[model samples]
Target: MPVPCIILASPRLRKTRWPRLVVVALFFVTNCMWAKGPAPATRIPLDPLGFQPPLAQFMLAGSSMLTVDYVDSDHLLLTYSTKKLLKRLSDCPPADQDRVVDGVLLELPSGKVLARTSWRTHDHGQYLWNLGRGRFMLRIRNTLTTFAPMVNLAKGDAFAQRPFIRTERRIGGVLLSPDADLMILETMDPRPSDQVLGDQPREEDKPVQINFFRLISLNGADIDVHASGALRSRVTGRIPANSAGYIAILDDGRQHWSFDFRSYGGKIKELAAFDSTCRPSPMLVSRSEFIAFGCHLSHTPQILGAFNLRGEEMWEQTMTENYVSPSFSYAPGSGRFAMSRVLTRSSLVDSDSFSPDMFGGQEITVYQTDSGRQLLHVDAAPIARAGQNFSLSPDGLSLAVVRSDALEVYRLPELTKEERKAVQMAEASAPQIDGDPSMVLSSGNGDSTGSPERSDPSTPPAGTREQPAPAAADASSSSASVAGSTPTPPAPVADAGPKAEAQTSSTSASQQAPAEQKPSDIQGDATPDQPRRPPTLYAPGEKHGNDPAHRDDPR
Candidate 1:
């Protein structure tokens, strides 16, 4: 930031003192503007947060940038909607438009609005979250209501109380645990027909669609389930493909489950048994990495990778477009993680289907969740869907974007003692894969695809910006089925706009047998958390309302 050069010098001969006028004005101001050549790329400095001109024009006219999180890093937790709930949020029904909602807490760099409030919400979108510092948690279905702002903001402290009763199971997700203590509630029953129908069924045959899992253990608003289970899928399966916390990858992605729900007493404990499988057109887990992508047919090729819950890989790649969505935001204790690349723009609607036009706009990259380095690279404009504009600051060093003109905030870049000694000398000359680098796959972009019994493994390497090349459109005219065989129906986007990314919507990344080459009576297994894949807030690929270990709707 240096530009003040004003050196005319004609009257100089009439005045040059012995100083030659401060050494020829410091050599034309160091080659005009403080000569610092070979340093041209720079754009991670934001810091907007203004909001006051009529509350920033009614917060960009309602639904206020749909939740710009972070309850600490100096407060920030906006959510707006009023103007008759933004004109009856699509055909009236919060009891006809006024169901109330408005929150503030702001504060950053003295853009002060410190506290403001209002609430009633029963699913309009983004149910709050951020349980560190001043506290925050709000969910609406499967009820969980917490808010503290240092304790008491018109009262709310019932973080969960639903002793199993939704008819035949109906809550599908409620996950938290990056240290919000622990949770993994799930309840699947209504999501069948991706059809596999083989390998042993017959309990009088067809009623299998169970997936109950419960493992709780929170505190503060108390919640203790400890263990609960039900996975009964006697054939007709389509991916235990991905799960989080007590880990699970089930049959299609081959198998990797790994649970330890607190030293086994109530039960849910199995670990180690990975390294194998490519059937990933979706597998995103968290609570110790797992990012799979593979599935774009023309005989497979998409590939992608990040692995290590023993499913190995570490970093592989390939995705020459097919609706590029790939998202991520995470900021737990700020070791950082951004990763975007949305671009859905697929348009078509019917003739076999294609969808993805959530206004289109992406291409991000924050990284350094370890050696993935690349501290901050930007590009966020297709407002409204795809990580809901942008947010990451639960101590990950600020970054709340809703840019068009205001509500910015970006301060996340640091680690230059020669870039942390070139990332600890490239994490000590790479090549460790699991246990070598792994805090869950980090040798970031030094690229590595060996080990795990090579055999090609679809090699592609080089990451940090997950799989950028985005600029989508041309899914080759939609409709396809062959991965788990029969699951083609993706094409609805006239409105399912907000709340996206912990993805799952494949063209099929087929080809299995990897969790240590499957089958062996495979018996139950799981990791620790699930229920948070909820913030792609619009589009990427998956539709799990989550992945904070909630995988897609952990609630």
Candidate 2:
């Protein structure tokens, strides 16, 4: 009976089962790899003093920190506090603590201290101008008076005892002409207001007097253009070299006026006037043809606009809610611009919802200059609590974001082949300073010999006037007659601001971990091309109506 039983087992079925099992195994492995994710961004510590957490830590702890200014392409005039002052900030009132304890001329690309000035009483305000040929002017304010000390980096002296200009009026602003030969200072007069009652004057009745000073030589031969006006805020930039004029945006609360200053005699002529619809803040003027400004209609949402030099509207876009302060950076190499803002999303609904918190993050958007087309958008987890600063590299190849603890640099998108060639040519033609290869020679105070060795026709020098390019001839032509045309009202465009969203869902988890994690937490063997997990834009129950499509691929 056993022999009679027929056995039936198919060899073909066994062969097919092995292949199916292999395919299932491959699918599981691929998904697991994707879930692990790619490595996070690389963070470079900006600390030169090896201060454990960075300078921003002491700054946030109520320590008065000095303002940092760029001296040249290779150097930054940085101010720091002594250990004593930093320690007192925690216990003593900020008014009692001395803010300006140390000064150091910092070298760029490599965060090295090139020179250190002798410690002196400073009022936490300083300005720097590169005087070409290894000479730089450092203006430091102590108490009510300001002193301009000259420093020669090649001579190894941090400060020269002789001051260039000593003034009683607080230096409200400093503008260097394109050639760096002429210096203009908007100084605020400290005289008592005529509206004073007895001794103390009412805040609203205080006189707002501004005196314009034009310095011809570094030795302080100055001309005072006694044009007294109340300027609440001012933005100035050099006109194109061919035109030899300066453009400025002056806000006096009631109106925002644009002025053109003739370089020959420091005469200012009003160009255009704008009524206060939104508080307008000028961002940057490029090639004397394009200008950018950020206006705050209210606290939550913002408006960013571009205008021709004639003050004609080019393009306008509306920013998202929860933006702390919008900032813009332009790249001359590619004629592109980037805007950044600190964004927050909250689970709790209240009047103070926009307050920056651990659930906050940062977003950056890039746009083309000609078409206003958005090029790229990137978002990252919260770097700092409230204040976040970012800057584009001179070459426009990298963008650096400074958080409270670390400096996060991301490589920018690749430029077109033509743009790359243009940048290389511009770099080659730029004037090279003697000691520092990175420092380019700028136009020195009325000295024709101090100009760069070879100037690029395509690129404009720093602080130089920029003429409209041939490609923009039509726009400039139309803008030239815009003075008679009424300014167009700011039109808000929906879903136009930065579109990057956060990827993490748990606020507590992100807060507990460092701003940047080790590569092991990400995929160990993943390539840079591998995509990371997209950050969550909203918290558990939060919603944003204006949020653009979430961009996960940074490339």
Query: What is the C-alpha local distance difference test score of candidate 1?
Result: 0.36
Error of 2 at 555 (Å): 31
lDDT of 1 at 242: 18
Please write out the lDDT profile of model 2 over residues 1-555, one tens digit for every residue: 011111243334355656866766766686675544322244545465432332533322212243233444445454444554332334332232243455666565666666676454433333344443234455554122222222444455655433344454445344443334434343433434232222543222222111222223333321112111111111111122212333333333433433232222233233344333432333333433344344444423356565444445556676655543343455655656667664546323232222333235567666655445565455533232222245454445555554444445555556777656644543353322222100111111111111244232223243333221111001112111111122222111111112113313322232222112111110011123532211110011111111111111000
- The candidate maximizing lDDT is 1
What's the distance in Å from true for residue 206, model 2? 3.1
Judge candidate 2 against the unseen true structure and give its global Cα lDDT, from 0 to 1.
Answer: 0.35
Work out candidate 1's RMSD over C-alphas.
23.0
Off by over 4 Å in 1: 1-66, 69-78, 81-123, 126-335, 338-368, 371-390, 393-413, 416-490, 493-543, 546-555
Once model 1 is optimally superposed onto the true structure by TM-score, how far is the C-alpha of residue 93 displaced, in angstroms? 6.6
lDDT of each: 0.36, 0.35
* C-alpha lDDT (0 to 100) for residue 461 of candidate 1: 37
RMSD of each: 23.0, 22.1
